[model samples]
Target: MQYLKRYLLICIAFICILLGIIGIVLPLLPTTPFFILALACFARSSQRFHQQLLNSPYVGPILADWEADKRIDKQRKKQIMLMIVCSFAVSIWLLQAQFHLQLLLIVIMFILLFCIKRIAEK
Candidate 1:
């Protein structure tokens, strides 16, 4: 049962990592949340994987900081906000013919911004 559980967690972790990567290209999917989930899973299933994730140059420090204090640095927060805005803007512009979808995207963008704003800064 323990082995099965570990296997399951490892699988879930990989899926989360994949989704996190995809989220980089598709802004609506979100990146950090998935990576965070992956980190949690790896922490439980494999210490090596957990350490590797923590050592990732791109997200490593951010994840490590989050794990330690659950806060993001001001500069990183600003970059995230900018990325969200730019991606949503491009998406909305591309879907100009679909007014309802555009409204939906706008709503989602605001919601994402609000959620990000709520996170405590480091």
Candidate 2:
């Protein structure tokens, strides 16, 4: 049973790492969260995997900053916010026929903005 759980965790971490890699190139996927998810999973399952994740060039610094300071660079935050807002803009534009959907999108946008604000800037 213990071995099964460990293997499952390894599988999950590998999947998350793959998703993180994909997210790097796909604008809609958001890489950092997947990388962080993999980090968390590997931390519980394998020490070596955790160390390798921390040493990764692209997502390592983000994971380190998030773990140590719970913060991200201000410029990164701005870029994220801009991308989110633009995506919302495109969605809202496309859903113009549905007033309720527009309203829902507006609410979602505000909620996302609030959540983003809660993340400390480095």
Candidate 3:
């Protein structure tokens, strides 16, 4: 039903926003994608929630810019790259003797870098 769909979207949005907040302290979980997901869900479910997300201090401008331009600022792209590197470094260092896992992590890092390269820089 329409109400059920709206409720699910709002729930998903809230969960994604929570994950985005947690990603602040946890390096492995990239925050922007989750925040972007939340924004989309909120937009479909509730204008007020969408506006609140748009007004957030740290993420607001980034979300607005992304929605309007589908582009990320140069500094943010660099930061994302740095975060990716640090996350992989930490994961590899912490998972000692897991050769296969380490290799997979390296692959993931490369993929992340490749994706990062594709994002338009402002």
Alpha-carbon deviation at 10 in model 1, angstroms: 0.7
TM-score winner: 1
Judged by whole-model lDDT over C-alpha atoms, candidate 2 comes out at: 0.82
Tens-place lDDT per residue, model 2, 1-122, is 98898889989999988887886555445567788888888888998999899988877877888878778899988887887788778878888999999888878777776777788899
> Candidate 1: deviation at residue 80, Å?
0.4
Model 1 lDDT tens row, 1-122: 99999999999999999999999999799899899999999999999999999999988988999999999999999999999999999999999899999999999999999999999997
Q: Which scores higher on TM-score, 1 or 3?
A: 1
Candidate with the larger TM-score of 1 and 2: 1
List the candidate numbers ranked by lDDT, top first: 1, 3, 2
Comparing 1 with 2 on lDDT, the higher-scoring candidate is 1
Show where candidate 3 strays beyond 4 Å. Answer: none
After superposing candidate 1, which stretches have Cα over 4 Å from the reference?
A: none
Name the top lDDT candidate: 1
lDDT of 3 by residue, 6-99 (tens): 9999999999999999987775567888999999999899999999999999999999999898999999899889988988899889888999
Clashing pairs in 2: none
Deviation of model 2 at 40, angstroms: 0.8
Residue-pair clashes per candidate: 0, 0, 0
